[model samples]
Target: MKYTKDHEWLRVEGDLVVVGITEHAATALGDVVFVELPEVETMVAEGDEICVIESVKAASDILAPVDGEIVEINDKLVDNPGLVNTDPTGAAWFFKLRLDDLAVLDAFMDEDEYADMIG
Candidate 1:
């Protein structure tokens, strides 16, 4: 798994990539109440604000890890926001992308480095 200092995780699956907030991030965000996802087929550049996750305390922009077109989004989050706080690494996955540049994946932090960053 690749990670970001901002507490997002990316894992490649075939030609697509799955993205979600890290456990630490979800915990910090508190009870999530809403999620805003980009429409499928939307083109996103690396570092683009592709989504927003709103918690009871604040709303956070979810950045893209690679330049890609959005292929899918987890619509489950729209109805069950607690999944973000309860299972951030699994059920709370926000979206998938058909990445254009795999090299951009190298810009993210590794798990250990990201853990340290969050601490």
Candidate 2:
């Protein structure tokens, strides 16, 4: 898993890239209550706020660490925000993007490094 200092993670699978908040992020956010996802096909730039994850404590922006077009979003999150707390890296994924620049992935932290940072 690759990560941003903001606590987002990206996983490349074939031509699509999956994005989600890291476990540390969810834990920090507390109990998530809602999520707002970008529409599919929306073009997003690196560092853009593409989604919002609202927890019982506060609302957090989900930034796009890579420039890309959103291809899919996890609708499950809208109905069950606790999924974010339960499985941040899996079922709670925010979106899948078709990246415009693969080089942006290099700017992010790797799993071990991210874990160290959060630890």
Candidate 3:
């Protein structure tokens, strides 16, 4: 998985890309109560605020890691927002993106770099 400075993570999955907030971000947010996801087919730009996660601590924007069109959102989040805290990098992913240009992902960090930067 690759990471963004804004605390979002993305990884290629066949024809699409999966997206979620980093574990550090989920932990910081406390228990998530609600998640506002972008609609399918929504066109988004790199760095755009495409989703919002509200937690006991505060609400935070989950930015698009690169330019893309949203293809799918985690419907499970509507009923189980706590998944953001319980399994952030797994089934709790916020969305899947059909990347506008895969090359745009070169701007992001690999897990090791992201870990050190956050540390």
Question: Scored by CA lDDT, what does every candidate get?
Answer: 0.89, 0.89, 0.89
Model 1: lDDT to the true structure: 0.89
State TM-scores per candidate: 0.93, 0.94, 0.95
Model 2, residue 19: distance off in Å is 0.3
Model 1 TM-score, all chains together:
0.93
- Top candidate by TM-score: 3
* Residue runs of model 2 more than 4 Å from their true location after superposition: none
Residue 69's C-alpha lDDT in candidate 2?
93
Task: Give per-residue CA lDDT, model 1, range 10-111, as digits (tens).
Answer: 998888889999999898899999999899999988789989999999998999877788989999999999999999999999999897667678878888
Better of 2 and 3 by TM-score: 3
**Clash tally for model 1:** 0
Q: What is residue 45's positional error in candidate 2, in angstroms? A: 0.5
Q: Any idea what lDDT model 2 has?
A: 0.89
**Each prediction's RMSD to truth:** 1.2, 1.1, 0.9
Candidate 3 per-residue lDDT, tens place, 1-119, comes to 88988888888898799999889989889999999989999999877988888998888888887778899999999899999989999989999999756777777899999999899
lDDT tens digits, residue span 1-119, model 2:
78988898999878888999888889999999999999999999888988998999998899988888999989999999999999998888999999766666887788889989988
Task: Report RMSD for candidate 3.
Answer: 0.9
Residue 87 lDDT in model 2?
96
